[model samples]
Target: MKVSLITATYNSEATIEDCMLSVLNQTYPNIEYIIVDGGSNEKTLKYLNEAAEKHSNIILSSEPDQGIYDALNKGIAKATGEIVGFVHSDDFLADPSIISAIVEAFKAQEVDGVYGDLHYVALENTAKIIRNWVSEPFDHRLLRRGWMPAHPTLYVKRDLYKKYGVFDLNYRIAADYDFILRIFKQPNLKFHYLPKTIVKMRVGGASNKSLKNIIQKSKEDYRAIKTNHIGNWLTILLKNVSKLKQFKS
Candidate 1:
Protein backbone atom coordinates (compact mmCIF):
# COMPACT_ATOMS: atom_id res chain seq x y z
CA MET A 1 0.00 0.00 0.00
CA LYS A 2 1.12 3.54 -0.64
CA VAL A 3 1.58 5.49 2.60
CA SER A 4 1.67 9.27 2.62
CA LEU A 5 3.92 10.65 5.34
CA ILE A 6 3.46 14.34 6.16
CA THR A 7 5.76 16.57 8.19
CA ALA A 8 4.89 20.15 9.18
CA THR A 9 7.90 22.39 9.75
CA TYR A 10 8.67 25.98 10.65
CA ASN A 11 12.14 27.33 11.41
CA SER A 12 13.28 23.78 12.07
CA GLU A 13 16.78 23.95 10.65
CA ALA A 14 18.20 22.27 13.72
CA THR A 15 16.19 19.07 13.39
CA ILE A 16 14.74 19.16 9.86
CA GLU A 17 17.62 17.19 8.36
CA ASP A 18 17.25 14.32 10.80
CA CYS A 19 13.49 14.25 10.26
CA MET A 20 13.83 14.20 6.48
CA LEU A 21 16.60 11.61 6.52
CA SER A 22 14.54 9.27 8.66
CA VAL A 23 11.64 9.44 6.20
CA LEU A 24 13.86 9.23 3.14
CA ASN A 25 15.58 6.12 4.51
CA GLN A 26 12.34 4.25 5.17
CA THR A 27 12.32 0.62 4.07
CA TYR A 28 8.92 1.11 2.47
CA PRO A 29 9.49 2.22 -1.10
CA ASN A 30 5.89 3.27 -1.87
CA ILE A 31 5.70 6.38 0.27
CA GLU A 32 4.77 9.88 -0.86
CA TYR A 33 6.62 12.24 1.47
CA ILE A 34 4.71 15.52 1.71
CA ILE A 35 6.24 18.43 3.58
CA VAL A 36 4.15 21.48 4.50
CA ASP A 37 6.60 24.11 5.62
CA GLY A 38 5.30 27.22 7.38
CA GLY A 39 7.58 29.70 5.64
CA SER A 40 10.67 28.56 7.48
CA ASN A 41 13.90 30.53 7.69
CA GLU A 42 16.43 30.52 4.83
CA LYS A 43 18.52 27.81 6.45
CA THR A 44 15.51 25.50 6.91
CA LEU A 45 14.35 26.08 3.34
CA LYS A 46 17.84 25.37 2.07
CA TYR A 47 17.79 21.95 3.71
CA LEU A 48 14.28 21.26 2.42
CA ASN A 49 15.25 22.29 -1.09
CA GLU A 50 18.34 20.11 -1.06
CA ALA A 51 16.43 17.06 0.16
CA ALA A 52 13.59 17.57 -2.32
CA GLU A 53 16.09 17.85 -5.15
CA LYS A 54 17.42 14.33 -4.49
CA HIS A 55 14.16 12.59 -3.49
CA SER A 56 11.76 12.19 -6.41
CA ASN A 57 8.88 11.20 -4.12
CA ILE A 58 8.98 14.32 -1.97
CA ILE A 59 6.36 17.06 -2.52
CA LEU A 60 7.28 20.32 -0.84
CA SER A 61 5.17 23.40 -0.12
CA SER A 62 6.37 26.43 1.81
CA GLU A 63 3.94 29.14 2.89
CA PRO A 64 2.41 30.80 5.92
CA ASP A 65 0.01 28.68 7.98
CA GLN A 66 -2.11 29.29 11.05
CA GLY A 67 -0.40 26.54 13.01
CA ILE A 68 0.73 22.93 12.90
CA TYR A 69 -2.83 21.66 12.55
CA ASP A 70 -3.47 23.91 9.58
CA ALA A 71 -0.31 22.75 7.86
CA LEU A 72 -1.32 19.13 8.53
CA ASN A 73 -4.75 19.74 7.03
CA LYS A 74 -3.09 21.06 3.89
CA GLY A 75 -0.90 17.98 3.74
CA ILE A 76 -3.94 15.74 4.10
CA ALA A 77 -5.66 17.47 1.22
CA LYS A 78 -2.60 16.98 -0.99
CA ALA A 79 -2.05 13.37 0.02
CA THR A 80 -3.09 10.69 -2.54
CA GLY A 81 -1.84 7.55 -0.84
CA GLU A 82 -3.82 4.66 0.60
CA ILE A 83 -2.78 5.56 4.14
CA VAL A 84 -1.82 8.81 5.89
CA GLY A 85 0.38 9.59 8.87
CA PHE A 86 2.49 12.40 10.32
CA VAL A 87 6.06 12.95 11.49
CA HIS A 88 6.40 16.36 13.11
CA SER A 89 9.46 18.50 12.40
CA ASP A 90 11.01 17.77 15.78
CA ASP A 91 10.34 14.03 15.53
CA PHE A 92 11.67 11.07 13.52
CA LEU A 93 10.76 7.47 12.97
CA ALA A 94 12.24 5.04 15.48
CA ASP A 95 13.81 3.14 12.57
CA PRO A 96 13.71 2.90 8.78
CA SER A 97 11.60 -0.25 9.03
CA ILE A 98 8.85 1.43 11.10
CA ILE A 99 6.73 2.40 8.07
CA SER A 100 7.22 -1.03 6.57
CA ALA A 101 5.94 -2.60 9.78
CA ILE A 102 2.90 -0.30 9.87
CA VAL A 103 1.97 -1.22 6.30
CA GLU A 104 2.27 -4.90 7.18
CA ALA A 105 -0.04 -4.42 10.14
CA PHE A 106 -2.65 -2.70 7.97
CA LYS A 107 -2.65 -5.62 5.54
CA ALA A 108 -2.43 -8.40 8.13
CA GLN A 109 -5.23 -7.16 10.37
CA GLU A 110 -7.37 -5.43 7.72
CA VAL A 111 -7.98 -2.64 10.17
CA ASP A 112 -8.90 1.00 9.61
CA GLY A 113 -5.95 2.25 11.69
CA VAL A 114 -2.73 1.18 13.34
CA TYR A 115 -0.77 2.86 16.13
CA GLY A 116 2.29 2.03 18.19
CA ASP A 117 4.41 3.21 21.08
CA LEU A 118 6.31 6.52 21.22
CA HIS A 119 9.36 7.82 23.06
CA TYR A 120 9.87 11.42 24.07
CA VAL A 121 13.62 11.97 24.19
CA ALA A 122 15.78 14.88 25.23
CA LEU A 123 15.83 17.57 22.55
CA GLU A 124 19.65 17.93 22.67
CA ASN A 125 20.35 14.20 22.92
CA THR A 126 17.75 11.91 21.38
CA ALA A 127 19.48 8.87 22.91
CA LYS A 128 18.71 10.20 26.36
CA ILE A 129 15.41 8.61 27.28
CA ILE A 130 12.81 10.88 28.82
CA ARG A 131 9.32 9.37 28.64
CA ASN A 132 7.86 6.24 27.04
CA TRP A 133 4.24 6.30 25.80
CA VAL A 134 3.38 2.65 25.47
CA SER A 135 -0.18 2.26 24.18
CA GLU A 136 -2.79 -0.45 24.53
CA PRO A 137 -5.28 -2.12 22.21
CA PHE A 138 -8.38 -0.13 21.31
CA ASP A 139 -11.43 -0.30 23.53
CA HIS A 140 -14.09 2.37 23.47
CA ARG A 141 -14.33 2.25 27.24
CA LEU A 142 -10.72 3.34 27.53
CA LEU A 143 -11.61 6.78 26.24
CA ARG A 144 -13.46 7.41 29.49
CA ARG A 145 -10.19 6.91 31.31
CA GLY A 146 -8.47 9.39 28.97
CA TRP A 147 -6.50 6.71 27.15
CA MET A 148 -5.15 7.54 23.72
CA PRO A 149 -2.43 6.26 21.44
CA ALA A 150 0.49 8.46 20.48
CA HIS A 151 -0.67 10.78 17.70
CA PRO A 152 2.61 10.53 15.75
CA THR A 153 2.44 6.75 15.89
CA LEU A 154 -1.05 6.63 14.34
CA TYR A 155 -1.52 5.57 10.70
CA VAL A 156 -5.02 5.38 9.29
CA LYS A 157 -6.64 4.96 5.93
CA ARG A 158 -7.09 8.27 4.12
CA ASP A 159 -10.78 7.61 3.64
CA LEU A 160 -11.42 7.93 7.37
CA TYR A 161 -10.54 11.60 7.20
CA LYS A 162 -12.91 12.14 4.32
CA LYS A 163 -15.72 10.67 6.36
CA TYR A 164 -15.01 11.96 9.85
CA GLY A 165 -13.36 15.30 8.93
CA VAL A 166 -10.03 16.98 9.71
CA PHE A 167 -8.57 18.73 12.75
CA ASP A 168 -10.76 21.33 14.43
CA LEU A 169 -8.83 24.59 14.38
CA ASN A 170 -10.65 25.90 17.44
CA TYR A 171 -8.48 23.60 19.52
CA ARG A 172 -5.14 25.36 19.72
CA ILE A 173 -3.27 22.60 21.48
CA ALA A 174 -5.66 19.68 22.00
CA ALA A 175 -6.64 19.30 18.35
CA ASP A 176 -4.96 15.91 18.07
CA TYR A 177 -6.83 14.66 21.08
CA ASP A 178 -10.10 15.92 19.65
CA PHE A 179 -9.41 14.33 16.26
CA ILE A 180 -8.43 11.02 17.87
CA LEU A 181 -11.60 10.92 19.90
CA ARG A 182 -13.73 11.66 16.84
CA ILE A 183 -12.33 8.74 14.85
CA PHE A 184 -11.61 6.16 17.57
CA LYS A 185 -15.11 6.50 18.99
CA GLN A 186 -16.76 5.22 15.85
CA PRO A 187 -18.26 1.83 16.57
CA ASN A 188 -17.66 0.23 13.20
CA LEU A 189 -14.05 1.28 12.82
CA LYS A 190 -11.22 -1.03 13.84
CA PHE A 191 -7.75 -0.16 15.05
CA HIS A 192 -4.74 -2.32 15.78
CA TYR A 193 -2.00 -1.72 18.32
CA LEU A 194 1.47 -2.53 17.04
CA PRO A 195 3.58 -3.37 20.05
CA LYS A 196 6.69 -1.45 18.97
CA THR A 197 8.16 2.03 19.25
CA ILE A 198 7.30 3.80 16.02
CA VAL A 199 8.47 7.35 16.64
CA LYS A 200 10.85 9.29 18.86
CA MET A 201 9.60 12.82 19.53
CA ARG A 202 11.76 15.60 20.90
CA VAL A 203 10.69 17.25 24.13
CA GLY A 204 9.35 20.84 24.37
CA GLY A 205 6.58 20.77 21.79
CA ALA A 206 4.19 23.73 21.53
CA SER A 207 1.48 22.20 23.71
CA ASN A 208 3.80 21.92 26.70
CA LYS A 209 6.10 24.83 25.99
CA SER A 210 4.77 26.97 28.82
CA LEU A 211 2.51 27.04 31.85
CA LYS A 212 -0.08 29.02 29.91
CA ASN A 213 -0.08 26.57 27.02
CA ILE A 214 -0.50 23.70 29.46
CA ILE A 215 -3.50 25.41 31.04
CA GLN A 216 -5.04 26.13 27.64
CA LYS A 217 -4.50 22.54 26.56
CA SER A 218 -6.29 21.29 29.66
CA LYS A 219 -9.26 23.52 28.93
CA GLU A 220 -9.41 22.42 25.30
CA ASP A 221 -9.02 18.79 26.28
CA TYR A 222 -11.97 19.04 28.64
CA ARG A 223 -14.03 20.69 25.92
CA ALA A 224 -13.16 17.89 23.51
CA ILE A 225 -14.25 15.28 26.05
CA LYS A 226 -17.55 17.06 26.55
CA THR A 227 -18.05 17.71 22.83
CA ASN A 228 -17.46 14.07 21.98
CA HIS A 229 -19.63 12.87 24.88
CA ILE A 230 -16.67 10.82 26.15
CA GLY A 231 -16.42 11.99 29.75
CA ASN A 232 -16.16 15.05 31.98
CA TRP A 233 -13.67 17.04 34.08
CA LEU A 234 -12.54 13.81 35.70
CA THR A 235 -11.52 12.50 32.30
CA ILE A 236 -9.23 15.46 31.83
CA LEU A 237 -7.79 14.88 35.25
CA LEU A 238 -7.09 11.25 34.43
CA LYS A 239 -5.43 12.26 31.19
CA ASN A 240 -2.97 14.53 32.99
CA VAL A 241 -2.33 11.97 35.68
CA SER A 242 -1.68 9.24 33.10
CA LYS A 243 1.39 11.10 31.79
CA LEU A 244 3.11 10.48 35.12
CA LYS A 245 3.55 6.81 34.25
CA GLN A 246 5.19 7.71 30.94
CA PHE A 247 7.86 9.61 32.84
CA LYS A 248 8.33 6.76 35.27
CA SER A 249 8.85 4.34 32.38
Candidate 2:
Protein backbone atom coordinates (compact mmCIF):
# COMPACT_ATOMS: atom_id res chain seq x y z
CA MET A 1 0.00 0.00 0.00
CA LYS A 2 1.11 3.53 -0.74
CA VAL A 3 1.46 5.68 2.37
CA SER A 4 1.43 9.43 2.13
CA LEU A 5 3.52 11.17 4.78
CA ILE A 6 2.96 14.90 5.32
CA THR A 7 5.08 17.34 7.28
CA ALA A 8 3.91 20.91 7.96
CA THR A 9 6.76 23.32 8.44
CA TYR A 10 7.54 26.97 9.16
CA ASN A 11 11.05 28.25 9.85
CA SER A 12 12.11 24.73 10.67
CA GLU A 13 15.67 25.04 9.37
CA ALA A 14 17.00 24.09 12.78
CA THR A 15 15.55 20.58 12.87
CA ILE A 16 13.58 19.76 9.71
CA GLU A 17 16.52 18.17 7.90
CA ASP A 18 16.63 15.28 10.34
CA CYS A 19 12.89 14.88 9.95
CA MET A 20 13.26 14.77 6.18
CA LEU A 21 16.16 12.35 6.33
CA SER A 22 14.22 10.06 8.63
CA VAL A 23 11.32 9.90 6.19
CA LEU A 24 13.56 9.51 3.19
CA ASN A 25 15.41 6.68 4.83
CA GLN A 26 12.26 4.76 5.69
CA THR A 27 12.39 1.11 4.64
CA TYR A 28 9.02 1.50 3.00
CA PRO A 29 9.60 2.06 -0.70
CA ASN A 30 6.06 2.85 -1.86
CA ILE A 31 5.81 6.08 0.10
CA GLU A 32 4.82 9.59 -0.96
CA TYR A 33 6.56 12.37 0.91
CA ILE A 34 5.05 15.85 0.81
CA ILE A 35 6.19 18.96 2.61
CA VAL A 36 3.86 21.91 3.19
CA ASP A 37 5.90 24.90 4.15
CA GLY A 38 4.31 28.06 5.60
CA GLY A 39 6.37 30.69 3.75
CA SER A 40 9.54 30.20 5.68
CA ASN A 41 12.15 32.96 5.41
CA GLU A 42 15.03 30.94 6.79
CA LYS A 43 17.04 28.03 5.40
CA THR A 44 13.91 25.88 5.53
CA LEU A 45 13.17 26.23 1.84
CA LYS A 46 16.80 25.79 0.96
CA TYR A 47 16.81 22.40 2.66
CA LEU A 48 13.51 21.51 1.01
CA ASN A 49 14.82 22.46 -2.39
CA GLU A 50 17.79 20.21 -1.89
CA ALA A 51 15.61 17.32 -0.77
CA ALA A 52 13.24 17.80 -3.71
CA GLU A 53 16.13 17.46 -6.10
CA LYS A 54 17.40 14.30 -4.45
CA HIS A 55 14.11 12.44 -3.83
CA SER A 56 11.93 11.75 -6.86
CA ASN A 57 8.95 10.79 -4.65
CA ILE A 58 9.07 14.06 -2.72
CA ILE A 59 6.84 17.13 -3.40
CA LEU A 60 7.31 20.61 -1.98
CA SER A 61 5.14 23.69 -1.50
CA SER A 62 6.09 26.95 0.20
CA GLU A 63 3.31 29.41 0.95
CA PRO A 64 1.57 31.27 3.73
CA ASP A 65 -0.92 29.39 5.90
CA GLN A 66 -3.14 30.17 8.90
CA GLY A 67 -1.36 27.60 11.05
CA ILE A 68 -0.29 23.97 11.21
CA TYR A 69 -3.77 22.63 10.55
CA ASP A 70 -4.18 24.72 7.41
CA ALA A 71 -0.90 23.41 6.08
CA LEU A 72 -2.01 19.89 7.06
CA ASN A 73 -5.25 20.34 5.11
CA LYS A 74 -3.23 21.30 2.07
CA GLY A 75 -1.08 18.20 2.46
CA ILE A 76 -4.14 16.00 2.92
CA ALA A 77 -5.71 17.47 -0.20
CA LYS A 78 -2.57 16.63 -2.14
CA ALA A 79 -2.04 13.13 -0.80
CA THR A 80 -2.55 10.32 -3.36
CA GLY A 81 -1.88 7.30 -1.17
CA GLU A 82 -4.32 4.85 0.42
CA ILE A 83 -2.98 5.40 3.95
CA VAL A 84 -2.06 8.87 5.24
CA GLY A 85 0.17 9.87 8.12
CA PHE A 86 2.18 12.86 9.37
CA VAL A 87 5.56 13.68 10.90
CA HIS A 88 6.05 17.11 12.36
CA SER A 89 9.04 19.31 11.50
CA ASP A 90 10.57 18.61 14.89
CA ASP A 91 9.93 14.86 14.86
CA PHE A 92 11.25 11.75 13.15
CA LEU A 93 10.22 8.19 12.54
CA ALA A 94 11.14 5.90 15.39
CA ASP A 95 12.80 3.34 13.14
CA PRO A 96 13.58 2.74 9.50
CA SER A 97 10.96 -0.01 9.26
CA ILE A 98 8.20 1.83 11.10
CA ILE A 99 6.33 2.78 7.93
CA SER A 100 6.73 -0.70 6.52
CA ALA A 101 5.33 -2.11 9.74
CA ILE A 102 2.38 0.28 9.53
CA VAL A 103 1.63 -1.03 6.04
CA GLU A 104 1.82 -4.61 7.26
CA ALA A 105 -0.54 -3.76 10.10
CA PHE A 106 -3.02 -2.29 7.64
CA LYS A 107 -2.85 -5.36 5.43
CA ALA A 108 -3.33 -7.72 8.35
CA GLN A 109 -6.05 -5.91 10.29
CA GLU A 110 -8.00 -4.18 7.49
CA VAL A 111 -8.84 -1.29 9.79
CA ASP A 112 -9.47 2.43 9.42
CA GLY A 113 -6.51 3.49 11.56
CA VAL A 114 -3.29 2.34 13.29
CA TYR A 115 -1.22 3.94 16.03
CA GLY A 116 1.58 3.14 18.48
CA ASP A 117 3.90 4.55 21.10
CA LEU A 118 5.76 7.89 21.02
CA HIS A 119 9.15 8.70 22.52
CA TYR A 120 9.72 12.28 23.58
CA VAL A 121 13.36 13.29 23.08
CA ALA A 122 15.31 16.22 24.35
CA LEU A 123 15.60 18.98 21.77
CA GLU A 124 19.13 19.97 22.74
CA ASN A 125 20.41 16.43 22.78
CA THR A 126 18.81 13.83 20.57
CA ALA A 127 20.57 11.09 22.52
CA LYS A 128 18.65 11.99 25.65
CA ILE A 129 15.34 10.21 26.09
CA ILE A 130 12.79 12.05 28.17
CA ARG A 131 9.61 9.98 28.20
CA ASN A 132 7.87 7.03 26.60
CA TRP A 133 4.15 7.59 26.02
CA VAL A 134 2.55 4.24 25.35
CA SER A 135 -1.02 4.82 24.20
CA GLU A 136 -3.89 2.67 25.36
CA PRO A 137 -6.13 0.78 22.98
CA PHE A 138 -9.25 2.63 21.87
CA ASP A 139 -12.12 2.92 24.32
CA HIS A 140 -15.15 5.22 24.33
CA ARG A 141 -14.82 5.50 28.08
CA LEU A 142 -11.22 6.71 27.92
CA LEU A 143 -12.14 9.94 26.15
CA ARG A 144 -13.64 11.16 29.41
CA ARG A 145 -10.30 10.35 31.07
CA GLY A 146 -8.27 12.31 28.45
CA TRP A 147 -6.80 9.26 26.71
CA MET A 148 -5.54 9.64 23.16
CA PRO A 149 -2.84 7.96 21.13
CA ALA A 150 0.03 10.28 20.50
CA HIS A 151 -1.07 12.38 17.54
CA PRO A 152 2.31 11.96 15.87
CA THR A 153 1.88 8.20 15.88
CA LEU A 154 -1.68 8.14 14.48
CA TYR A 155 -2.14 7.03 10.86
CA VAL A 156 -5.47 6.57 9.15
CA LYS A 157 -7.02 5.59 5.87
CA ARG A 158 -7.16 8.42 3.34
CA ASP A 159 -10.87 7.75 2.93
CA LEU A 160 -11.52 8.47 6.59
CA TYR A 161 -10.71 12.11 5.90
CA LYS A 162 -13.30 12.14 3.14
CA LYS A 163 -15.82 10.40 5.39
CA TYR A 164 -15.43 12.22 8.71
CA GLY A 165 -13.58 15.54 7.91
CA VAL A 166 -10.33 17.40 8.27
CA PHE A 167 -9.06 19.28 11.28
CA ASP A 168 -11.27 22.19 12.34
CA LEU A 169 -9.06 25.26 11.90
CA ASN A 170 -10.71 27.03 14.82
CA TYR A 171 -8.77 24.87 17.24
CA ARG A 172 -5.28 26.27 17.69
CA ILE A 173 -3.62 23.35 19.48
CA ALA A 174 -6.43 20.89 20.12
CA ALA A 175 -7.70 20.28 16.58
CA ASP A 176 -5.75 17.04 16.32
CA TYR A 177 -7.30 15.84 19.55
CA ASP A 178 -10.73 16.74 18.23
CA PHE A 179 -10.15 14.95 14.94
CA ILE A 180 -9.02 11.75 16.69
CA LEU A 181 -11.99 11.85 19.05
CA ARG A 182 -14.34 12.33 16.14
CA ILE A 183 -13.00 9.29 14.29
CA PHE A 184 -12.46 6.88 17.19
CA LYS A 185 -15.72 7.69 18.98
CA GLN A 186 -17.70 6.53 15.98
CA PRO A 187 -18.82 2.95 16.52
CA ASN A 188 -18.63 2.02 12.87
CA LEU A 189 -14.96 2.82 12.36
CA LYS A 190 -12.37 0.10 13.01
CA PHE A 191 -9.01 0.98 14.61
CA HIS A 192 -5.89 -1.12 15.25
CA TYR A 193 -3.32 -0.52 17.91
CA LEU A 194 0.31 -1.45 17.18
CA PRO A 195 2.50 -2.01 20.19
CA LYS A 196 5.66 -0.22 19.12
CA THR A 197 7.19 3.21 19.14
CA ILE A 198 6.34 4.81 15.80
CA VAL A 199 7.61 8.34 16.21
CA LYS A 200 10.25 10.23 18.16
CA MET A 201 9.02 13.74 18.90
CA ARG A 202 11.22 16.56 20.15
CA VAL A 203 10.28 18.21 23.40
CA GLY A 204 9.04 21.85 23.66
CA GLY A 205 6.34 21.76 21.01
CA ALA A 206 4.05 24.80 20.80
CA SER A 207 1.30 23.30 22.95
CA ASN A 208 3.51 22.71 25.98
CA LYS A 209 6.12 25.44 25.57
CA SER A 210 4.88 27.57 28.45
CA LEU A 211 2.35 27.82 31.24
CA LYS A 212 0.31 30.34 29.22
CA ASN A 213 0.10 27.91 26.30
CA ILE A 214 -0.90 25.11 28.67
CA ILE A 215 -3.81 27.26 29.91
CA GLN A 216 -4.79 28.01 26.33
CA LYS A 217 -4.56 24.31 25.47
CA SER A 218 -6.91 23.52 28.36
CA LYS A 219 -9.44 25.98 26.96
CA GLU A 220 -9.11 24.49 23.50
CA ASP A 221 -9.48 20.96 24.88
CA TYR A 222 -12.78 21.98 26.43
CA ARG A 223 -13.90 23.40 23.13
CA ALA A 224 -12.97 20.12 21.42
CA ILE A 225 -15.07 18.21 23.94
CA LYS A 226 -18.04 20.48 23.33
CA THR A 227 -17.71 20.57 19.55
CA ASN A 228 -17.43 16.80 19.32
CA HIS A 229 -20.20 16.34 21.89
CA ILE A 230 -17.84 14.11 23.80
CA GLY A 231 -18.37 15.41 27.36
CA ASN A 232 -18.58 18.35 29.78
CA TRP A 233 -16.02 21.02 30.66
CA LEU A 234 -14.93 19.38 33.90
CA THR A 235 -14.45 16.06 32.17
CA ILE A 236 -12.22 17.64 29.52
CA LEU A 237 -10.08 19.39 32.15
CA LEU A 238 -9.45 16.13 33.92
CA LYS A 239 -8.54 14.47 30.67
CA ASN A 240 -5.94 17.14 29.99
CA VAL A 241 -4.41 16.62 33.41
CA SER A 242 -4.32 12.88 32.83
CA LYS A 243 -1.80 13.57 30.05
CA LEU A 244 0.66 14.96 32.63
CA LYS A 245 1.71 11.43 33.54
CA GLN A 246 3.26 11.09 30.10
CA PHE A 247 6.10 13.31 31.27
CA LYS A 248 6.85 10.98 34.16
CA SER A 249 7.42 7.96 31.97
The prediction achieving the highest lDDT against the true structure is: 1
- Give the alpha carbon lDDT tens digit for every residue of 1-249 in model 2: 999999999999999989998999998999999999999998999989988998899989999999999999999999999999999999999889999999999999989999999989999887777877888778788887777888999999999999999999989998999999899899998888999999989999989899999889889988888888887876866776666677744
TM-score of 1: 0.98
The best candidate by TM-score is 1
Overall local distance difference test of candidate 1: 0.95
Looking at candidate 1, the ten consecutive residues that score lowest on lDDT are 240-249
lDDT tens per residue, model 1, 143-211: 999999999999999999999999999999999999999999999999999999999999999888899
> Pairing residues by index, what is the TM-score of model 2?
0.97
Candidate 2: misplaced stretches above 4 Å? none
> What local distance difference test score does each model get?
0.95, 0.91
Residue pairs clashing, model 2:
none
TM-score of each: 0.98, 0.97
